[model samples]
Target: MPNYAESHRDLDSYISARVPVIGMRTIEQQRALRLVREVATHPRRSSMPFWIYTRATGLRDLRTNAPLQEDRSLTGAMEYAASQFTARPNATLVLVDPDDLEGDTPLTRHIAEVARLAGNNSGSIILLTDTPVWSGLQRLGMSLQLDLPDADEMYGVLAGFLTDHQGIIPIAWSEDDARRAAETLLGVTEAEAVNLMATVAAKGSVDKDDVPALAQSKDRIFSDLTGLVKVQLKDADYTVGGLSNLRDWLRRKNQLMQADLRHTEIRPPRGVLLVGVPGCGKSLSAKAIAAEWKLPLYRLDMGAIHGKYLGESEGRFREALETADRVAPCVLWIDEIEKGLAGRDDGTGVPQRIIGQFLFWLQESRSRAFVVATANDVRSLPPELLRKGRFDELFFVDLPDAQDRKEIIQLYYRRYVKAEPDPDQLARLVDLSEGFAGSDIEGALHDVGAEVYLGGGAEALRPSFVMDTFANTIPLSRNNPEQIEEIRAWGRERAVAAGRTAGATTQGAPGPARRIVFMED
Candidate 1:
């Protein structure tokens, strides 16, 4: 339904009329050039135009098939274009140097002079750069912005690519899928996409199923080392007990995902902040959700992100976000988020600035990265981060209650134990492990096995051996009652209790009831 070819035609018309300057922000450079070519050959246009193009990075000289010696200097290139094309046509193409003109540079003076020369010759100039440094040029009456390839244009480009190698379509491609793929290619060049498609097609047929994988691989190649990793969401029905309210919240999120498919325009949920006791399955939930959604999972290691250089940290952060966008509809796991932000107070303000940038990106980004940030200490985080809009929901993971503990014990025993254990024995073990988190219960089970091994055989050690380990291990709740109570009190009203009834009390008072919905059979 969307027509990209028509959009390209409209853009071409606007540029050919001596528009002075045009800004094109798109992934496909060839498509941009094609639009320019269309405008150049418009029937309504009387004469051909000579144009001068400027790039921050040196441009390859098409004439010599080599880098031009003069290409390094914008002033010289403009002067040469002005002299050479003075008598030729309606528009003169001059390529300007971005570095020579960027931030507080004398390039502004040269641009003005070049603009005046172009006006005298009845031609126009175009400037291209990675970053649009247009403020300087805008003041000199040189500000014409062009739209990037719309849905229709993208479809044409993709169709052309597919047709060139694979021939006619065996089955009609879904326009929605094609448009999404095009949008994912945003900020990527046409040459890059063509080359990537060529590589993919070389392996096998470039069909619909291959699109998702190809899209992910292309992003991995271009966006630097720290790209997004795809993770599949877990089966909700198989998830162990506790946060009843959290389950309800996930149902709403699923509903949103479905709604987005229908409308073709959906803003992704902001993210989630999971804070509570350590080893309480906070990190596990992240992986479970990924498996549940049938997406890829990538864990963000803060240690890997911190760079020694002045600007490297920011660069790394940007690259990470870009990678996530390129490999859309994936999860990014940030474990111990508080620890990552803990190093923020170095006094140099670099870390603070980075945090601010991350927050801004989280709020404004249109990427499909569903962030799942886990933290054990909430006090270490800044107050601004706790604000409502930063995360879709803040869920507290407390120590497992009796029911939850029983479920966890069953899950682990079913996974690791060779023989089926008695249900009564499992209930007794769960009762003994009261006040203990899931991790502690697992550790206790490990201790039981160790005792049996040390005694030379399973028959040598009685059930009392396991019970002794459970009794001796002081739970974190007993060792640090004040801290645990404080966290529970703080998260009582504001946070949803995970792995329990929606209306279950974490401390003493009743909260709002959460509606539980299973995402799997």
Candidate 2:
């Protein structure tokens, strides 16, 4: 990155010289004016340098001395400049155009013509375009670029914006927030910033709490550039019980935020991967992680991102990543990730390329957006994704054991009945749910409830309702026993079990046993 002082000085020097052609790559009108002034006041190499200013909309006559008329083209602008400097003979000609000259057909061609016109006049011409336009103008020979706002500039801009507001006072923004926002909005022009602030202020009293929303709104406003949508975690309640060890790990992560405030390079905690049987709360744990982190959750639906148009999928993924960075200190949940990015045998490399890009961003991103990716089959995932440093931990969610099943039953009973179910009835239900996952157990409860409602009322229903539900349902362990055992055996050596076992604690105490739960098929 060029130093701020160097960039500013370079631009200043470029503007001050009576060069035949000068190009400025920036979006701010004020900065462009500053550059023009610097060049106009510099020691003149010639007695007169004609100034030709061109814009899509003609310059306003602030003096109210004449009616306003649009120049519409660079050729017309040059004529106007000649008229303005007729008496000076060797006057400088400054051409100012709000539209990027490269994109404007006639204007670009006129640039060469204008240069010829100022050949012996000791005049200068300046072209100004927004950042987007500048990228296309790279081939147009040496030009000056104004540096984006740094941390200090952000502070000044934010402070000034706040001071000018007459509504509720804005709270002091943290350095981290300011730095992150500034970097994410780097190429944004001053006018864009002002517009963002105005939109934010219009909704509510601008404060610290409102910053996230403002940032989200800005991301949405630029949705074409940042394709991301807000996501909500619906299963936060699942992490409350039977996952003590995992919860403790999460708690420790939260503590790290306060450990050393002075350290500026603190890495945001990389997230975890939950892999195991279907409905074993892998997805639920992702929701819980977001809740624990106290951040907004965004579910990156790969299906939504995949497009029929060539290269569109990759573009969408990049946009999503950029948006995630823009709205930092958030969570990105990529559910069923293995299936989402699986490459086909066909020669199309789009999936591979898109996944590669995603992983690269995951490893190098400086944003605080935590990524929680869940998958059912590890064998299908690319090995590079599972390597150390990609995610902090990988957990295996096996079938919930007997003890976990008991807890699941109690939790659901209390939630649905507002009281404990009969202990004997609950015991029987747990016994029958041996190899079921949390989701299966919930389904069983739903079946029992449906039976009770059909039979007339709660009085007519008994433990038999649950027994019948169990009898009617088929356990997944029976059909996929080999797969289940393979997962468990593989997890024994590699992953932390997400279940309650013989060595597990029941009083919500954290232990070494992988937290697990059993469900009815």
Candidate 3:
């Protein structure tokens, strides 16, 4: 039902061609063994007897549950296998968990001898293990790999699981919900998928409520990892004040992100690279993207990816990326990505190699882990990274202008102060906070609210308080004028502005300037 026709055909072909040895790495040992039996015992094929061996189980008949008790050890099993071909050609010996085999004494030589002898006869040896192949056995054998089950297979698994537990557990999923859940459960092993579904059913129901639980299960997959962190949103709808153009683009792509777009020819959207001033809501946009899209947000701390041991960084990085893929249809936020990739070209080339791996994966991975990478300093970023096709788009989030400032003022005031400033007051606040970033507006309003709370309670928090506090506070743009100017210059020619403006190219243009309005000082 899961359609192992391709794998079966491949195995049958190898056996028919007298390939003496076959090697495969897989977690689903039972499934692989069943496939081998199916191929070996076929009605049309010659009668090829199959035997199995493991350290724990020793040597046993593949068709019958009978065991060869005397020849149970690794050496004994190898000797028995080598002897069997003399009497019975086309005998297949399957070894399970060869990594558990003790010592190097004659096991390697015996295995090699078996390979040589098996070639003369039609006998074959199949080895299975989860460990990386470090032994020379690979040279003598054809290596194969079993892929994770596809959607149709997973749906069958889910449907069968639900049917099996219908009386024992409650399942409220519609046909569509079951299909969607099966789609999300793709990329994980059959065991993992089964366990996850069982987990939901254990709670007595598998419905819309189980969907978040399924996503949260993916969080557990990343919990032990060092580099990636799960970001928790206080409000699932954490909206950004500005970035009109970028926001609109995301709005359009939202539906595509929600569905299983794997089968489609159109490559799913890779994601955007937000490059701009430090306090211009680049990082915040990452959180907002997850909230707005209704996807889990994982922050990949590039700084934490490195390790002291050799190859550890790459291994951790690969695992992290794999985990992200496993949890598809999610947002991966790499904050200040340039910091991780900067200065990588110098030194030992570890960081450079990491960047190389990241770049390659970003372009090639079919996984829908929409990457939202934010960078403050464009000069630190490598030219290759910024080249076309690295990301879907590169957006420059500059300082909030007049209209954006007003939106930020109102949004934050309502959030922190729990009171909305009327239009007249909001306009005055925006004018006073010109050249401020969305973050600056929020911070200034928060500080004013604190002072008002201490001096005169909620009634004391008014437009004048915000104006006074903002006027005294120096925003990051003002404090680091040279840095902001350099970033703006870099973005002016290369990047698309996140906000809307009049004389804009299809790419983007800087938004309108801050309007000057005199408020009581």
- TM-score of every model versus the real structure: 0.71, 0.73, 0.85
The candidate maximizing TM-score is 3
Residue 366 CA error for candidate 1 (Å)?
2.7
For model 3 the local lDDT of residue 429 reads 75
Could you arrange the candidates by TM-score from highest to lowest? Answer: 3, 2, 1
Tell me the deviation in Å of residue 244 in model 2.
3.3
Q: Candidate 3: minimum summed lDDT over ten consecutive residues — where?
A: 502-511
Query: Please, what's the RMSD in Å of model 1?
Result: 8.2
Candidate 1 lDDT over residue span 1-521, tens digit each: 11346545545554555555444443445455555555555666545643434354443333223544455455566666666445655654635335544454577666656666666666666554445654666554443334444334555677688667555334334666565556545444456666676676676665566555544555555433383433334453246445556667876885553232424665777678998877788888777766665445677767777788887877787777766655555667988888767656687666787688778878887666678899888888877778888888888887777788777777765544433457777777776776677777777767766665677755565665555666666666666767777776666766777766322333421223223222221
- lDDT ranking, best first: 3, 2, 1
* Candidate 1 total steric clashes: 42
Q: What is the alpha-carbon lDDT of model 3 when measured against the actual structure?
A: 0.76
Which portions of model 2 show Cα errors greater than 4 Å? 1-10, 16-57, 60-75, 81-104, 115-138, 143-152, 161-229, 232-241, 254-263, 291-294, 304-312, 344-346, 414-419, 422-424, 451-461, 496-521
Off by more than 4 A, model 1: 1-28, 51-80, 94-115, 131-219, 222-248, 258-266, 298-327, 339-360, 382-384, 418-420, 445-472, 502-521
Worst 10 residues of 1 by lDDT: 508-517
By TM-score, is 1 or 3 better? 3
The lowest-lDDT stretch of 10 consecutive residues in candidate 2 is: 502-511
Winner by TM-score between candidate 2 and candidate 1: 2
